[model samples]
Target chain A: MLDIKNLHVKLEEEDKVILKGVDLKIEPGSVHAIMGPNGSGKSTLSYVLSGRAGYEVTDGSVTLDDVDILDMEPEERAAAGLFLAFQYPVEIPGVGNMTFLRTAVNAQRKARGQDEMSAAEFLKVIREKAKTLQIDADMLKRPVNVGFSGGEKKRNEILQMAMLEPKMCILDETDSGLDVDAMKLVSEGVNALRDAGRSFLVITHYQRLLDHIKPDVVHIMSDGRLIKSGGPELALEVEQNGYADLKADAGAV
Target chain B: MARADLKKEKHEATEARISTLNMPQGGTWASMARNEALSRLRGMGLPARRDEYWKYTRPDTLIQQDAPAAALFDSLEPAVFDSVDRLKIVFVDGVFDAAASDDLSLSGVEIDRLETAAAADIHWAKDVYGRLEARGQTPVARPLAALNSAYATDGILIRVTGKAAKPISLIYTHKSEASDAILHHVIKLEKGAELTVLENGPAASRFNKVMEVEVADGAKFHHIRAQGRDHERRAATHLFTRLGSESLFKSFTLTVNGALTRNEAVIEFSGDNAVAHIAGAAMGDGAFHHDDTVFITHDAVNCESRQVYKKVLRNGAVGVFQGKILVKEGAQKTDGYQISQALLLDDDSQFLAKPELEIYADDVACSHGSTTGAIDQDALYYLRSRGVTKKEATDLLVLSFMAEAVEEIEDESLREEIVTRLTGWLERRSG
Candidate 1:
């Protein structure tokens, strides 16, 4: 349902290119994992797709279900069913988590020309979704990630993903700061949301996260290009050994 | 001869300004205080633009010969504290309207009009009528407050002996665009008594107001005021309070759109173990200028004082804060804190502040800080990404910045009401 064609990006403030000639395509109802080493343009690709500021798209285009998302505003991209579970979730000091969620949900609905959700309906759905992700009422009541632990922030991100229920999801290094238990809880939350119409692009440096979520397609990326693509066995291969051999192979290919 | 001629001309000009206002005639003590205040005004004159304390704010509009014409504000919402059951004292264009005011009957308190009390044969309010304003003249020349004392003819006199049943509210309503209102109120709380006072509405196009309060030992006093929303009003108000041993005093002001506003508060602790907290939140937009000048003194042992002020300015609005805390000698273990902050919503808005601390005590803890900043870009982006509109995001952040001061209100219900009012203000601007 999501397509990226010959994408190229660079830092807006500097003349430094981060993503060069990267291409990817995800089919509907499939989980694709992008495995890359450090500075492989993994996070830059996600930011460019999510319409973050200060990122110049030198070339190429990103589309969600045949709709051009790069031309849309960040909020418009959100309304277009793009969800980015950030690597480091932002901390808002005074905006309550519940209020943030409600605003986001209603805004997206309003943009889509749908009826606004009432506070009572929002509270009920958020409570049920939060329970599954191990988020208590207090976490939802407090300011967004202001004083949460590392594990709690990751889980709250998952809670947001659950509430938004986007058609396409991008988890950029979601396992970097999570503990093993947190990883299981997050994976379970993702697994519960899996359906025939929604697609996920899980980006990570380690293969342990793939073991829990079980990607249908694994792509090895180095130097901003996907060199090899295979089934789940490719993730195991990179885990058992290291990316040292894969790096040479990617370079040669 | 040139210098002497210049001084004489300046004195004549000042005399001309003071001659326009009529001095309230109270019996012996009131007359004496008015004479002294008038003499002080003669020396100090109206504040000039070059004066040190008036450097950031211009006082010319307030001291002008006629009250400037201000368009009357028509609010669809009821005046603040209307739902809260209160003893209402109504004033129409600086003059007390007996027909609109409730009977001066409240349990645990005695009340009277300043004009009548000054004219009466016997009254306890004579002791505090203008004494605090006179005391405030030192260390700084508040000629405007002194001017109020000399000329103000109408206000309320309150004496509390026990816990009040409900709040006493002063409601000012205006019908004339050129009305100039000068009001001076006096309040006294006896030993171990408690009371809450509230003031609301834009009294007139041009207004000068002063309120003097004295809290006896172990007494408590709470004040909450809403300086009305006349966009072209030029108002100058002063609050003078003194706290006795183990007494507590707290005051908060919500100031809004005005052509010019100067709110000055002077507080002194006379007895040991007293506490005072003064806070204000002001929001101004489009040709508005607001000022808060406060001075707090700790004279007794183990007393605490706090001053918190926050302002939000947009569309070339100007805000000023000048606050000072002084700890006297032998007043050991004194605790004082002061913070003034402003959130400028645009590039054109301005905030000017001068925070000072004077400490002679050996073991006192005093800290003061001032900051002016724009809304956090990251916070704004975060809110926007979550689907909040740009306007809505900005209003939320501005409210959060001013929330710290709003939370200082002790009464929960009143605090909530003020918050709703602030939120409504933001909503109108954002829309």
Candidate 2:
């Protein structure tokens, strides 16, 4: 459902290259996790796919359902069923959480030429979804991400993903600041949306998240490319023996 | 060349401007008050570019010999506050329109036109006509307010003895392109009484207005004003209010689409344990210049005052804010908070702010802050990434930036009206 081939990205304000010739593909109804150390361009890959600013895709192509997404704006990409759950969700001081979610839902619906959701209908759906994530009415009423705890932020992102129901979802370090309980709650929320048509690209530094939401495939990214691809057991190997040996092996290759 | 010659020239120029205005003919007390205001205006002269308070905003358009011509705007949108139940008082081109206004009588309150009340031999309005405006001139000179007090031709006088049944709505409609309108309103709330006043619409092409409010002990006063939507109209408005012991005063203004507007609010706390809040939200696009100058003084023990002002400007628009909070000696436990922020949508827009705090009370808590910034790009991206268009995202951010000032409105319906207007203003400029 998602494809990235020869993705070579460099910082727009600098000549330094981030993602150099990275390639990955994920099929429908599957979850793929990318494990890497710091500065390994894993997060950069997610940002490039989401069309974030400050990066120039020098040479690469990304597609969702065989439609080229490189030329689309961020909102267009979103309307085209691309979603990125930010690691650090932005703190908007005055935009209420409910208002933001409703606006986003209606905006995407209008972009897709579908009927907008009514306020009553939206409140019903959000309340049910929020219950599963332990997000209460107060959290939904307050400004988006303002004064939110780390776990609350992560769960809020999951709630957004649930609301949007995108064809492809990219989670960039969703487990970074979350505790064990939050990880399980978020993993359950993600697992609930694992339908036949949805796909996930989970980028994380640790395998603890994989323990909660099992991945069909795991990739070990060393420099700017995926050096190894294997099953869930690969995560165990990396957990026991860190990326030090993997880096040496990739360099030798 | 010398200071004396400069003063004499300024005095003569002010007199020339005054000679062109037709003072409203009234009875003994009203005429005396107008004459006194005239002398005060002469002493201060009209605001000049060299004046410290007028440095950021030019006073030329406000004090010019002839009112500059402005094209009338035909708005298809319904007037704000239409949904609320209010006593409507209409003014067309600065002249009171009795036929279009509601009955002047309301339970628990007495309301009369300034022309009629001033024509009476004895009236309660005589005590408040320009008293607060005169008191507001100390430590700073507001010659434009003095000019309005001296030559105002029409207004309303309200005295509240009990809780008002509904808000008194003063609607100003501009019908003449070159109409230079001057109006002064006086409101007196008796002990333990309460009242709310609503003002809206563009009065005229060139408008000067003053409102003086006196809140007696334990009384309450609320004011919400929306400046007219005529894009080429110019206005200078002043609100002078004094709060007595245990009284409460709150005022808010929303300004949209004016060529130039200067709104000044001066509040004084005279009795212990009083509270006052003044806030404004302004949006200006091309050729728009909006200014908000506020001075709040805490002179009684344990009084609280807040000033919140926010402005959104784009396409070379300019916004200025000069807010000060003064805590006098022996006014222990006084609390004063002031914040003025501007969101510049583009690099071409400008925001100039001067926040000052002069305190002599060691036990007082007074804080002031001012900021100018562009739209938060991170927040914008977060919104756009959620499938909202770039324009919509920017508008959301702008609204969020101004929400603080808008929240100062206490009434839910009034606040909603202001929010709706804010949204409409953003939508109209999106094109």
Candidate 3:
């Protein structure tokens, strides 16, 4: 459902290369995890796919269901079913959490030429979704992510993912700051939305999170390129041996 | 020119402007007050470009003899405070319209016209007509308010002895192209009394207004006003209030779409343990210049004051803020806070701020902050990444920037009304 080919990216303000000659593909109804050491360009790949600023795509193409999304604005990319769960959710001081979600949901729907959801209907749906995420009325009423705990922020991101229902989801270190219980809760939320047409690209530094969501494919990304691809056992190998030996082995290859 | 010559020239200009105005005939006390105000204005002279307080804002148009012509703005939106049940006092180009106004009778309060009260032999307004204006001139000069007190044609005088059931709404409508309107209002709140005043409109092509409020011991006063959306209009307004012991005062103003507007508020704490808050939200687009000047004095012990002002400017619009907090000797335990922020949507817009604190008391806590910036890119991208259009996201952030000032309104309905107007302004400019 998602495809990337020889993606080349560099910092827009400087000549430093971030993602160099990277390529990956994910099928429909599948879960993939990209594990790498620090500064291996895992986050850059995700950012490039989401159309964030300050990154120049020197070469390459990324597509969702064979439709190119590289030229679209961030909002248009989001409306076209591309969602990126940020590592650190922005804290907006004045926009309420529920208001932000409603605006997003309606905006995406309107962009897709679908009828907007009524306020009453939205409230009912959000209440149901929030209950599963353990987000209370007060949290929804408060400003977006202002004074929110790590667990609450992750759960809020999951809640947004569930509401937007994007076709392809890129989780950028969603488990970075989450506790054990929060990881379980977030993984459960992600697991619940695993439909036949939805795909996930989980980027992580540890296997503890994979234990909860259970990806089908694992890739070892080193030096801005995916050098190793294998079954779920690959994640266990990296967890046990670390990326040091993998880098040497890839160099030997 | 030498300093003496400059002063003489300014005084001569002030005299020239005063010579053209015909002071209304009134009672002994009123006439005496007008004469006092005229002399005070002459001493200070009108604001000039070289004045320290008027550096960021020009005073030529506001101080000129003939009011500049302004094309009437045709607004489809309903007048502010139309939904609230209020005692309406309508004014067409500064002339009181009795036929369009409610009767001058309400329980717990006494309402009278300044024209009528000033002509009487003895009236309660005689003590307040120019008293507060004259008091506010020291330390800094406000010649415009002095001029208003001296030659204002008509205004409302309200005296509240108890809780007012409904708010008194002052609505101004402009019909003449070159109308120059001057109005002065006096509000007297007795001990433990409470009152709310609501004002809205573009009074005339060139409008000058002064409102004097005396909040007695333990009294409460709330004021919410909106300067109308007349793109070519010019206005200068002053609010001078004195708070007695344990009294409370809060005022909020929302301004949008005017060519030139200068709003000044001076508050003095006369007795101990008083609280006062002044806030404003202004939005200006091309050819617009809005200024907010505030001075708060803490004279008694343990008094609190807050000043919050926010402005949104785009397309070469200009905004100015000059705020000061003065804590006098013996005014220990004073808590004073001031913040002025501006959000400039484009590179052409400008914001100038001067925040000052003068403290003679060592045990006072006073802080002031001023900032001018563009939209937060991180926040903007976060919103756009969530599928919100860039325009909608910008509007949301703009509203959020002004939310601090708007939140100062004590009434929920009034806050919502202000928010609706802000949203409408953003939406109208979205394209």
True contacts kept of each: 0.42, 0.77, 0.75
Off by over 4 Å in 2: none
User: What digit string (tens of lDDT, one per residue) describes model 3 on residues B1-431?
Assistant: 78898898888879888887999999988899899999899889998888999999999999988999999999998988889889999999999999999998889999999999999878998878899999999899999999999999999999999999999999998999999999999999999999999999999999999999999999999999999668899999999999999999999999998899999999999999999999999999999999999999899999999999999999999999999999999999999999999999999999999999999999988999999999999888888889999999999999889988988998999888888899889999864
Report the Cα lDDT for candidate 1. 0.89
lDDT of 2 by residue, B1-431 (tens): 77787788778779889989988899999999999999999889998777899999999899988899988999999999999999999999999999999999888999999999889788998888899999999989999999999999999999999999999999999999999999999999999999999999999999999999999999999999998589999999999999999999999999999999999999999999999999999998999999999998888999999999999999999999999998899999999999999998889999999999999999988888999999887788788888989999998998899888888999999999999999988888853
Residue-level lDDT of model 1, residues A1-253, one tens digit each, is 8999998899999999988888899998999999988898898888888777889998998899998888988778888888888888888765679988997899889989999999999999999999999899999989889899988998998898898889899999999988899999999999998999999999999999998999999998888788789999999999988777888876733
Candidate 1 chain A: worst-modelled 10 consecutive residues by lDDT: A244-253
- Candidate that beats the other on TM-score, 1 or 3, i.e. the better one: 3
What TM-score quantifies how close candidate 3 is to the native fold?
A: 0.98
**Candidate 1 local lDDT, B1-431, one digit each (tens):** 57566557557767877778778667876787788888888877777766789999998888877888999988898788877889999999889999999998899999999888888666898778788888888889899998888889799999999999999999999889999999999999999999999998899999999999999999999999988678888899999999999999999999988899999999998999999999999999889899999999888999999998999999999999999998889889999999999999889999999999999999999999999999887777666666667787788788778867887789988887788788888888854
| lDDT by residue (tens digit), candidate 3, A136-226 | 9999999899999999998999999999999999999999999898999999999999989999999999988999989999998888899
In model 1, what are the clashing residue pairs, if there are any? none
Off by over 4 Å in 1: A236-242, B1-10
> Each candidate's DockQ score against the native complex?
0.52, 0.82, 0.82
How high is each candidate's TM-score? 0.93, 0.98, 0.98
Candidate 3 chain B: worst 10 consecutive residues by lDDT? Answer: B422-431
Error of 1 at B46 (Å): 1.9
